[model samples]
Target: MPFTGKSGKFNAAIRTVEIGTGDKAVKLGGENVLPFYTFDAPIENAPKIGVLITDMGLENEVAGIKDYYAGATTFAEIAKKAEEMPGADFVVLRFEGADPNGENRSVEDCVAIAKEVGDAITAPLVIEGCKNVEKDAELFSKVAEALQGKNVLILSAREENYKAVAAAAGLAYGQKVGAESAVDINLAKQLNVLIGQLGVDQANVVMNVGSAAAGYGFEYVVSTMDRVKAAALAQGDVQLQMPIMTPVADEAWNVKEAMASEADMPEWGSQEERGIDMEVETAAAVLASGSNAVILKHPTSVATISKLIKALV
Candidate 1:
């Protein structure tokens, strides 16, 4: 007699989260099994990709992506370009200049730029701050108020500032919040719980598991995400069941493999192709590991990963 392999069943499924409204809306998560485990179960919704933009304007953008920003000086122009890109499902507006150590832009300036980009694009927006906990709370709150009813996903509410961010996004604006954790499943769950305690429904939360670039402990990040999904599905953990989002652009692009010029490292081959590959590969890793959506930087990576997701699904 021949023996066959045993198939396992998951007790829970990833919860679905919707962003935007009307014709521009998109749903993430809702998979009953692990990422791309089609043989075991059906995938209710395919992963989505959001292109990352910044308030830094075109001149400050990376050289590889400058062409996409051609003749687009303002936030509105950049948002338009991002919305028109072939594979961009949504746009992420990163307020990098708002860091108190950086440009230290005022809350008014950040809110103004957020409104401009939010108004220009019909696609859903993911508004992120510059990682300064105190400043980010204030900035996010003001931006959420400024763009009410846009259904934007506020990029982060950490353990340090979840209360203010969650209150502004979930309670005040009725928007979504990206609850972040530092590559730990327990912390990821805990942050979700804290956000929930603030009266934000679990459905309005998305996990950001602190992405690590390829070759720089990427496997650690991947495994952490995998474990988070396993706890959500196999263990029926409600706090971990929400969809996950990874901001891969900054991590992938900033690495030396992507930023080093061809002249600086001839053995690495073409600088352009290398950088694109770094982003595409990093995104693939995260998606396979358990990302329901990702925020990418380069247009080429967006198109490439879009193809990869279609093929996978």
Candidate 2:
């Protein structure tokens, strides 16, 4: 008898979720096997890259990312830069100024900026909240109402604020919501269940299984995501089947390796190159772990990661 290798089989496939509408929409997830496992099963859609834009403008951005928007002054300009970038599939409008302890910008101000950017770019927008749970719930609610039916992805709904954000996303706006959890697979699954119970369709929910920088507990993130996907596929868990999203840029840029200057550590090499590599390497790791979309900063990393994905899938 001739020797033959056993064929691999998967019980469930990742759910496909659509963001935006009409000709500009993008599909995420929809894979029957693990990330880049094309030899085992066909991939329905390639992973996507979402460029991060902020309401605070480039002056408030980290030094490493400021050059990308030199002379740009408005949200419209930022959207234009993202659209022109080679691999940008969507835009993330982070309302950093909405933090109550920070600028404490009004909800009206944040909504105005979101509307401006949404109208400026045809690419789908992910309207991210300031990390303040209470403030984000109220702020996101108003924003969702204003942008109803535009097909935006609201980021996100946590244990403390899932009810308000989920209701805004599914009931008020008919949009999608990102359900976030700490780096625990069970917590992630529970949040997804809670979001669904709030009347948001499971298909409209995306899982943000938590993110960590390259040298800072990134392995934990990988393991959590792996387990989440495994439960969705091998264990036949529907609530855990939503696509995974990782906001890599925020975590990657905040780390010492990405933020430290050459003067601080000459042996570490150029800060610019190190920062770009940090973002690129972190994003690559997350994608390889079955993330369907990654929110990124810096055009250099975006282009590099895009090329890497092309060679991969």
Candidate 3:
């Protein structure tokens, strides 16, 4: 008798969330099995990667990154350089300049830059605010209106600002909404439910469920994602079935291991190498554990993770 394998495919599948438009548009989720479990079931989408660029600019970036985008002075030019990086699936525009406690940039300035990048790139765009609840509430709404027909994905409509973001970006202008939550399964599900109640289709909502550097309490990140996927697939939890998009660049690069200078800790080797390692490690772990998309900073990290996903899926 021939050996037989148990079917691991679940009855329910993760919802597909589409961002952007035309040929460059990317689809996330649409799998009924665990990540990379192609033997169980073929994945409808092979995950996706976004290159993250801050509005403030990448002045202190590593040599490799600097070399890749050499002479790209403007925001639109820089974003185009990022999107052209090998294996990049989209562009994530982070509004660090719009933070009230920091740059305190006005809504008009933010909207101007957003339109520049939005118009410049044919690739899908994801707009993430500066994490201030009030600022993001206004910033996301204004930017959403600015990039109306572009159909961008507004990252992170948290409990605090989901109402404004979901109503304007999602319902009115018809863009994808990212329902963000802290790294808790219940919190994520609840936020998703609330966003859905506002009439944003599940297919148009992606979850920014939170993340941390690898080994820096990232066990919580791993477990939370695993639980979300299991419930969504095996338990048929509709509210938890939205595709997950983790922003890995900030957390991974800001960690002590990635930031420590080679002069300070010779044993840690090059600072650039450490940062790439952290980004790649955290991203790979999250994808395997269940993220449908990831935002990475370094060009090398994005290329490496892109290859990893391509090889695995």
Largest TM-score belongs to which candidate? 3
lDDT of 1 by residue, 1-313 (tens): 8998555558688999999877988998999888988777678788999999888876655676899778887889989999888888999999989999989999999999999998898999999899999999999999999989988899899999999999999999888999989999989999999889889999998889899788898878988998998899989999899999999987887888877888889999887777788889989999999999988988889999999888878
Q: Per-residue CA lDDT of candidate 2, range 108-150, in tens?
A: 9998998888888888889898999999999989888888878
- Pairs that collide, model 1: none
- Model 2 global lDDT (CA atoms, 0 to 1): 0.88
- Give lDDT: candidate 2, residue 259: 77
Report clash pairs, candidate 3. none
Query: What lDDT would each prediction earn against the true structure?
Result: 0.89, 0.88, 0.93
2 against 3, candidate with superior lDDT: 3
lDDT of 1 at 284: 94
The candidates, ranked best first by lDDT, are 3, 1, 2
C-alpha root-mean-square deviation, each candidate: 1.5, 1.4, 0.9
- In model 2, pairs of residues that clash are none
TM-score of each: 0.96, 0.96, 0.98
| Backbone clashes, each candidate | 0, 0, 0
Name the lDDT value of residue 97 in candidate 2.
93
